[model samples]
Target chain A: MTEEQTRENGDAPRGKEKSEQILDAVKERRNRQRESAAAEEKTVNLVVFILDGDFYGFYGEEIKEILPYEPVTFVPGCPDDLLGIINVRGDIESVVNLHRMMGISPGEPTRDTRIVIASAEGIRSGILVDGVEDVLDVPQSEIKRPLATLDRSIREFAVGGETLYNEKYVTILDVGKIFSKIVH
Target chain B: MQTQTLFLLLFTLKGIRFGVDMEGICGMEPLSRTSEREIPIGWFHEVLSLEISRSDYQSPMVLYLQNAKSHFGVIIESPEEVNRQIDLENIRPLPKLMEQLCRISPVWGAALTSGKGEKGIVLLTDLFRWRDLSLKIESKTATVAPPAVS
Candidate 1:
């Protein structure tokens, strides 16, 4: 029987079968392209730091440099988060206590404390951290949103969270939002 | 004040320990030394006002070692001592228990946790930020007069 006559007799049609095979091939190619794009987008580097005995990280690209802690000049009538101004490389930067920013008690600076220099919205500021951990390669799929119970300020500052191989939670900071308010 | 480690005079209130940075605190004087009549209106009613001598010859301010909002003043029954040169490494974050107590007042001192945990240092400066923000909001609301009735 001819192909049209076979379809009328309730048999598999030749033309319909060929079109289905072509459609399947297009879908398979599209899926392969999408998978590779997703994989490429997930790769990024981050520098992690400890604050309030908890681990937090920010994208490495956002950080300018990490420096040793120096005495901060106290300015009267400044905001509580502002620990005063510090002279870093002849440029004055506002030093902020991350503990205070996190709405936690401020810890006195120890030998472990490090000042992390970062630029947000073109305005450079320094954040005092309890200690510097290490730089890590964190993939995008590993990051998730913060729990609802986390502090509201933390939620605002963090873009997402990641769980390390050891299963500890690491929060990824959003530098743009952090600096946007300060720059204005 | 130039020292790396800050000293704080630790005290107890409502069964919780609270601390203030030694720099922010002038000297802690006897409660009997200051007269209650000189105390401010919003000062903690339960605390016996103590004279706090500060820089810049202004009037000596009264110190109240109690939660001002709740008016629960804690009496320093025993002699209070100062904790000196507490290293930052030694001070740990506030435990879940102490954090709850801190919300009641901004004047909490140092909290001692059990099981070899480090003492939690409380900063009156940090604690007052929340109160200051609330007061600003309140003042703004009060200053803006409501629409007058027709």
Candidate 2:
């Protein structure tokens, strides 16, 4: 607001104290805006999903799309984690089981099962999950380092950080790291 | 845009459908009529190490492959598609990690079919690339002489 708008009276008041008060108000507003802009850069958008009764999330930008259980053709000699390949329209995409990678019991494919097609670091594939929870815009500050007691296998590549989402603790996954493991 | 028709010889094995390039298939015959001395026959699943339910082939058919001196033929199950054609663009390469597996497996690519009652990905197998393995264990007792000069 202009100096006149911050005046004690609707008309311009003539006083040194009054003018000083108006200047202070304007500076406070500017400081607030700067703070929020800094925080915005740290905010991250995530897509949360459920796997083996645990909550997990991936960066929103890494996920390309989510599709229902499609016909997956089992390929011989493929690793256990590589469930199969599916026909996405005319494109062929490999379906991966996250439960196997996370060391969790694999759940049977059901109506709630979803395939999240994600791409990172020039690698792309469809990750099969038990269910999808929700998408959230979480602040980076809320994301905490993984538990010290966590297994060395999972914490090394999969875990990005953990945070609370909808009163549930979600383990953020590092998409690029996960893709690299499969590619390598 | 120019559209190319991909001719494939499709067949079923252990309930999964597979296709091969028709340009390489020379002829097809019933298993009983195929003579071992003339051409060597190999099981499709065993040659490429494809996993499937083991079952007796009561009426297995042999597909003779061209461009091989051994005159190799592959035994396949029912629903043999001799000259089925689909769009060439429909065939896509195996994604990422799976592409590396193709180095050991015969299935290097796949195609999607939307035809009525036959809608799914058809795995493309290349038997011609692994022709040398066709004659393995064909003659148990005696080894036949090599093919004569044509």
Candidate 3:
């Protein structure tokens, strides 16, 4: 059949359509890149961890390292929040139980317990979490500011919130504000 | 020497002696049983339920302490007592000692050598530094629940 006749009849051969599909694919890829770049600008990297089945994360840059849970020496007269001192590479680092800090029931640590080493205002400390989850690229648009009526203590520690694809909630902690009142 | 006077309210926890400033402490009372939900973070040991008579309504006030800014219930073994005041001016700063103690406990300002030649005074607010540490330990370490006391 002649090209014009086929075009007018709308019965173009399959080979002619291949080029159009390729063009559409390139356009989709460019749109995806633009979307990703915009997302990257708004969100910060967060290392997410689990505590009592709830998801929580901290700014990835704020975390120094993640270590295995080690035995700590309990000190008398220490605050109930103070888990004890752990010897991390010969330096004693105070460890806080994230579950206890969140007012959750204390659960025995298994192999999953991980110590997240973080520094706030030059005060180096370790936080014990139930387990270390994958690091997420949380976008700023997903974060929701905490409501004013939230508990005073809880509000002080929270920086913002992030929503997961499955519609689950994750709290982004403000490590600096948590330790701002503490004297180093 | 001109001395800065600091009034301390002394208390005990797990048989260890520590003191907080009188100004930091609102009040103290005998430790009582508290509901599990009412206790705040970092204060697992100090949670207590107490009754108060204010105006025509009698309600319960949950007395909490700040450990590194984390609120925990205060379980007072004995009624809080106002211990003697120390002169801050007379006290010498123990930078080395304070740094060492900070690793283990929350000690901020210290008062060295009272006029009568006693141990130096250590500020109690520094104890809050370990609030996260203590809670972390409690969660990981297996603990036997204390027997119910009548």
Prediction 2 TM-score vs. true: 0.81
The whole-model lDDT of each prediction reads: 0.55, 0.75, 0.56
TM-score of chain A, all candidates:
0.73, 0.79, 0.70
DockQ of predictions, in order shown: 0.02, 0.58, 0.03
| Candidate maximizing TM-score | 2
- Report the lDDT tens digits of candidate 1 across residue range A1-184: 7888887999876565877899999999999999998886686788888888888888899899999998764433344556655556544566766677677786888998999988765556788898889888777777776777777888878886755634677888877776553433
Winner on TM-score between 1 and 2 is 2
Model 3 residue A163 CA deviation (Å) reads 2.7
- Leading candidate by DockQ: 2
Candidate 2, after superposition: displacement of residue A113 in Å? 0.2
Better of 2 and 3 by TM-score: 2
Tens digits of per-residue lDDT for model 2, B1-150: 775987888887755678888887788877666555555556677765567533544467777787835456677775456678978778888888686688766677888887867788888888775564434434221233222212
Worst 10 residues of 2 chain B by lDDT: B140-149
DockQ of 3: 0.03
Error of 1 at A176 (Å): 3.0
DockQ of 2: 0.58
Backbone clash total for model 3 is 21
Worst 10 residues of 3 chain A by lDDT: A175-184
Instruction: Select the stronger candidate by DockQ from 1 and 2.
Output: 2
